[model samples]
Target: MISEPDLVKYLPDCQFGVNSATRLRFDFRNSGSGERVRAPWYRPLCRQDFLRPRTAAMEYPLGRHNFLRSNNLEEMQDVLGRIMCPHRLSYLDKPEPLDAVINSFDLGNLVLNYVQYGVPIAVDPGATGDFYALQIPLYGNALVRSGGKTIISTPEIMAVTDPEAPLYMELERSTKLLLVRADWDFANRVLRDLTGGLLPWKLRFDLGLDVSAGRQCQWFTEVVNLVRRADVGGGMLKGPMWVPQLEESMVARLIQLHAHRYSELLATPAMPASQRVFGQVVDKIEAMPEQLHTEGSLASEFDVSSRSLRSAFQRYLETSLFGKLWHVRLHRAHLDLLWATPEETTVPAVAERWGLWEPLFTQRYGENYGETPEQTLRR
Candidate 1:
């Protein structure tokens, strides 16, 4: 007798956007205020889902860059430790030949990874490190243990892990995962800025993603895909300009949309900053966007603390100081793109003039005006 294909068994070939590979890994919705859901690790897939023949010899793209064709557990562990994170990989089943793949991208303080394993395994990251992680399962599922809590990470639900804690996971034979990591400082700053300096305590996210209505998962996915597309086209990751903007937007969105210890505080309406403080920072950003304009430098320039400056930007502009600077540079680049002649100006040249790269410029332009720099130049 044949059984129906469970959700994990089959993936549509044409779903991901990149020519190589890009797919949403986590979409786990919170169960309830205090409810915990445990999903099974193993789900049988239909034979038709096999790419070639589901034989002992098969290769899968790691993420977007690497591939795993060999089943050697040591090689897999070594590659993972070097490229993504360090962990102990152990087979749960009878070590019946392993097959796996991994792909990763680093953007500013945020790291994204896509991984899949063909055999049941146990993963124990002794300590998660100084970064927060959100693990989403694209195909199949896994059981994650962290902070004395066990949560099922599946397609409809994601696991949120605290960086200061240790975590363990049990993977199914066909488990594929998408993981997002944010630096502690980056995440902390985003929360503080978003709340207009009213965050009086540490911020902690719930173990599960808040997929409940109005979550910013869709927005986060768009940003992730946009970066992937730019990288695939080439030349975007060459500079630091566009990366920080994308990273800040991504982090800020996560804080605003997800359910966490500070969710209620973030949702509280923020008080506006004083006009005097706002004007001072805007002047500095407009006058010298190309300068090493960190919050510390800007605060020192205007005789204000970094916290004060962040609050001013958050309260008045609803963005970080760097975010405003990004906008200023972006606008200048847009004008230059319009004035540039195709014979003398290239996308890279124009982008470099504003500290951005060609691919980023193209992506940003398309996003803002629904046209690319090349298209804009043609007209």
Candidate 2:
């Protein structure tokens, strides 16, 4: 891989420089026309039509990731602004010059944001919020002044914003950032399980997570890479099944990697009754894979709220209520196929017995078993 410095020599046609070791300054002007042209951000899948929502599945193929491309500041208020809480986005240098594009993907408990204003900009919000935000600069740096601490977020070091702090962020004109926003309630639930109950103190992190080296970089890189891969266009990426696993992994990795006040307690968290219930629930599913199980059904049987039950599964099992059930059902189908009477059973019959059908059944079966049900039966 080429070092960041050698970029200038390799890219002779473009102007590039590092300002303050934070700003990745690059200016590319249109040669044919005297107007400025923004670089491409969205993949070819949705790049063809910016008007269409990238999340729509049937209307277009694999609306892989949500995308927004606009020069309008007011428009961002409705899209990025809403999710980020009440905030004001403004151009720092010029009032009218703005080329902002944002792509956000949801992972149940957390959200991954890829944002770029393509101009010097500031995001202003209230004094306190209910989420933890980890900002990593992919292209350029951003200065984060939050909770009475000022941190310059670069590629090597990430800036962490806790829920208790007010947030003010300014990005240089040449910057693209990836931010992971973890919801307060969801985070608390995970932490609570780790500590057996909500501690008297709130979860807080140091202003910066030094990902320049060590385990911090490894974990952060792993989570970010997973997000990038998940954002790719595909039928499976759109499935509801993968969400819980993604959420659990994101929260778990952040908890394990990031330096926080509860690091000691979280490191050796106690397993509670709820965790036992989650395990027992797993056993129940395996014992009777043929039974139809839903979150509400499982929660009722276990004497816990559906939300708590979900949390238990997400925290301890790293999967959802339905996700585990689906896995068990798939496993049962495979077993049936493995010992099938070739003359008496068909792929469709085996699949149907386990509430599976069609090409999707074949697809899911192949993915889970490394072969089609037909192949398993043939053997």
Report the number of the highest-TM-score candidate: 1
Report every candidate's CA lDDT. Answer: 0.60, 0.62
Query: Model 1 compared with the native: what TM-score?
Result: 0.67
For candidate 1, lDDT tens digit of each residue in 119-141? 89998876677777778776688
Q: Using lDDT, give the best candidate's number.
A: 2
Q: Which ten residues in a row have the lowest lDDT in candidate 1?
A: 1-10
Task: Give per-residue CA lDDT, model 2, range 223-327, as digits (tens).
Answer: 544453454533224444434544654565566568788787656533323777888788988998666465544555776544466567768766666567667
Clashing pairs for model 1 are 26-136, 27-156, 28-156, 28-157, 28-158, 62-101, 62-102, 62-103, 63-102, 63-103
What's the TM-score of every candidate structure?
Answer: 0.67, 0.64
